[model samples]
Target: MGSRITSPEDAAARTAPPMRSQITAPVAKMALSSRIVGRGDASFDGAVNIRVETSGLTTPPIVTGKVPAVGSMITEGKALLEITGRPVIGLAGVLPMYRTLTPGSKGPDVLQLEQTLDRLGLDPGTVDDEYDTDTSRAVERLYEKAGYDAPEPDGRLTQAVDAAKAQVDTARNRLRQARAQLDAAKDANVRDTSVQQGAVDDAEENLVDAQEADGEAKFKASTPLPVSEIAYVKTLPRRVDEVKVERGGTVDGVVMSASGASLVVTLKVDAQTAQRLKAGMAATLDLGEGTPIAAKVRRITKNGNQYDVVVAPNRLTPSQLALLRDANVRVTIPVRSTSGKVLAVPVAALSSGSDGGSRVEVLRNGEADLVPVIVGLSADGFAQVAPKGNAELSEGEQVVVGR
Candidate 1:
């Protein structure tokens, strides 16, 4: 700012205005304070919709039994519905049944089915890859008990079983030949024993492979879940949310809706607000004008300008679970904030000093002095600030909010 001074006395008098009386105004002060002022909808917690698809041999079969009611809780090994007049029981596994499991089946799908069968009280051989005689027998028993015809071993499956068995035999023979040769070499004045040793080493590897192949064969005589008894689900003991199939209805696609034991509430917010929410952050769940319960942010998935937030309750009783299932609820996730009381001032009190730094004018003894301060987290109407260096500032002291 350019100023013209007619004389030294005039310059001094004009540049420095007379000090005014102390401006007693509202103080930017604080007391033990905490604020959870964020607003979000409060509804009952919702459930996760798990698609219930059949896994038995038939692509689409008629539902022969009564479908589980919408509110029924189906535990592990419990039947969801009858398909093809055979009950497809729920089993806990990550892999869904993809193909028919007959004799000679060899894959993780088969392995999982085998394990499930064993767990279900139906012995599927050694519970390995091979659907051996034991696995075939188990499948037959399961179907027989269910009053349905068991799965029969197809020609191709039988051939596969035979081939695997033959390989094992071949491996065993080769090992025997190598061992005999090694013995002969040992008894004789064998030069270049390395060849004998190498043969023995090769035989050992062959025998191991043979043993694995031999165990992998699903035999016609084994009792396995004839591709009709197994049902794959992400988790066990899921509650049935809806039943799309009934007696005589097509059980081809998702015949029911289910979910895990826990229920959660999902909400979306703009990215800016999403930034304030974090996974595992504590939250307050409001169920209408009802009592509030504690919750935690279960997950936060970001998508462009939007964010999906999932919150799970800390605990829920059986009654609460039934009440809140699929119920819309408001979840309040407190933004990351300054936890406790701190020296603070009204943001309006802060002014840019001549040095371009933050400072507040302190009004005391009918005079004002600039006190430099470092600003911190702001919440509600207070901005956390600390006096910098020797700049005198005290807790509960009045600071000039404005002129």
Candidate 2:
């Protein structure tokens, strides 16, 4: 039978422990003795208690083979408590495990492997960073090159799984060699002096030329051709001639605004080339004829090729306009013309020397004497040389490019 509560206090007493319940306690003292050893400095500590608890009620002592000698009583006590509650107990030494896998001993990275395979002339097809059939084929070829008994480059790699280990060593060596070359090129001071010097000079010259030509070409290409107003006149005797412009009548599109009938030759030249050319510059116009017509450049347009320049006849008259119309002409644009005595060499006979200078392998005393010459302006495949005392070099002298 359950007891019924008459008051709230009675209900609380029934729900919890009864307040009237009391007991007498024992007064005997017990001491605990503990020693922390097996470390650098041995230590001891004792604690006393006045409880009448049973001997079996004490917590089990923690035993350890080695304890690091650190902080005094505070740290030692905390470490002891933690070590007892640990789920695992073992020695302080590391476990013996073979370090077979290193920083790079895993399977090859697909991207780099694909690049290397391509470099070795083995097409891995796609560089998608996947170890697909193509990658396996490339690996097999690599193994074969490494002197391993691997299967063909068809992705059948099961039989040579162990032998394929050799491929890693071979590929690593190749990677080292490539890295060495890159390092050497990067460190200018350590690079081959002759090669670096020549490469730097040539690169600088090429870059300057490319930039100049690019800017000139863009500026010239964008400028519109010049338009001019013309007054057309019918031909008559000079004293009785009259010039007139009709309201709608047009002469067959006079290409040139200059007087008289002559052809206009529009030539495109870079700023550098234009510096050498000017109005009244004599040029030979070859209108696909075996013989060329001698013409004087009568006008120089502000924009070369983007605008046309009228070339007047130094000889012919209006009779030549029929010959000039619709005629495709190739003008002989001369860079330079030299006739006076100058130390000259045939262009074909010139070759770059090992010491980074231009040379002409001239036949001297029946033996090839490679003469390093500083060449000047070249015209028609003949370059003028300076320090001119090479009287031995003549117009028809044979020079060699190589022995």
List clash counts for every candidate, in order.
33, 0
Query: For each candidate, what TM-score against the reference?
Result: 0.66, 0.32
lDDT of 2 by residue, 15-105 (tens): 9954552121211112211111110110111111101111211243232212322221211011111112221111111121112111112
lDDT of 1 at 193: 81
Top candidate by lDDT: 1
| Residue 387 accuracy (lDDT) in model 1 | 88
Report residue 19 deviation for candidate 1 (angstroms).
Answer: 16
Q: What are the runs in model 2 whose C-alpha is more than 4 Å off? A: 1-263, 304-310, 317-319, 340-343, 352-357, 386-392
lDDT of 2: 0.40
What residue runs in model 1 are displaced by over 4 Å at the alpha carbon?
Answer: 1-60, 115-127, 133-218, 288-291, 318-323
Please give, for residues 1-403, the per-residue lDDT of candidate 1 as tens digits.
2454277787788899678644434444554233343334323333344334455444677778847887678776656677766677677788876666655668898777678779878876687877667767776665665555765555565676788889888888988898899889988978778888898899889889877766665434344454555667767777777777679877555667777656777778878777776788888777665578788888888866787787788987787666676567766676656656668888788889888989988877767778899988776667888889987788767788654
lDDT (C-alpha, whole model) for all candidates? 0.70, 0.40
Per TM-score, the best of the predicted structures is 1
